[model samples]
Target: MSATPQPVVRRGLLDEVTDRILAHIRDQGLRPGDRLPSNRALSERFLVATPTLREALRRLEATGAVEMRHGSGVYVRADLSRLIMINPNRLRLDGAALLDLLEARELIEPHLAEAAARNASDAQLDELAANLDRAGRALDEDAALHTANMNFHRTLGRLAGNRALAQVLDSLIDLHDQEQRHILTLYADRDHDHHVHLAILAAVRGRMPVKARRLMTEHLRDVRDVVIRALEA
Candidate 1:
């Protein structure tokens, strides 16, 4: 039998270990609410130190993947949808941090869009359309529109089917989700952003990877400039 592929990291970090543990659960056919092995046993199994294992377990708990009780053991949560969503309270973005965040988005998001164009299934496209539809109707309602906008991008990330990429982008973008209304104000044409999203979705749906990449890059560039303006204001 062919050996399973291993991750290329020299030693797994907390995030890597978190993914591994989740995979282990799935492979073992452990149902939601099933108890995971004890910390000592899990540490030994993963070849990680106790402290490192605890850190990984804590990360999983934060993402709602597992619940850790003070006296009780860990168990998987029934809802994993929370896994892809980031906690806004954990964000501490100042000027420099915001710049770095947007810079990273500019670098990564275009490629993600290209990949989504190549890899997205029909259902993913439908989800994108649904998000866009919701956003379009909520333009007058700032908070709702911003939320729909954020979901739209996150859905795009999922469409790429790259869990690592989706997780990183979610963390980075969630930093700005709360600030979206302020940043989105920089667009002179209120509906322009929605139109751009549609164009990107059409590119992805049409299997135009290059167009998808270009549109996504331009979208990020616009957003980055707006964020800079907002920070300066």
Candidate 2:
């Protein structure tokens, strides 16, 4: 006998609103960094209650679609163009899961670094240099340094010219963001991390693919070791 068909799941209003908001963004040709309409304006446009609209905006914010800045309004972000993304409602990763995440990064990011060395343009190299400079300046500030470090990895992944792997890396980065920051606090060697980044940037800037790959592998291994110690302690 044939099995019965499963019931179809209906879409929620919030999901519908999220889709509409995305459509609105595309229809208006809004690019990254462009400002969106105000919450009141959006609520009116969507014909939804203020609370419902706010919830929809929150959903979009979680996926990196928009940044809602207090006293500054909402603006677009680059992730809006990404084809794949992490689930915003994912549970916090446990210690084992966190290590697995790092292992995945170690496997993927070194290849990206090598590719960046092979394919990155002069302008992209300059951007990596500027990122390292910012990281140097933020060495004493944990939050700033963390943001700079994450940006360097993200930018390097994109410079590899592999959109599919880049997007996967992006999702991995976002997935472990909280755990990574916590690990940074425990690792507590900002200078060492910064110096390693400088070395990787040098290899990439010099267009030395083998050197870049080796440096990235060493860098991630160091990070993984720190995380392992943190988990044990």
- Pick the lDDT winner: 2
Q: What's the TM for model 2?
A: 0.79
In candidate 2, what are the lDDT values of residues 1-233, reduced to their tens digit? 87889443235878888899999999999999999998899989988877777788887898899999999989999889999988867888999889888999999999999999999999988998999899999888888888899999999999999999999998898988888898887685899888899999999989999999999999999998998998888
> What digit string (tens of lDDT, one per residue) describes model 1 on residues 205-233?
99999999999999988887777777787
Name the lDDT of candidate 1: 0.82
RMSD values for the candidates in order, in angstroms, are: 10.2, 6.9
Question: All candidates' lDDT scores?
Answer: 0.82, 0.90
Looking at model 1, residue 213 earns an lDDT score of: 98
Q: CA lDDT of 76 in candidate 1?
A: 86
TM-score: which candidate is best? 2
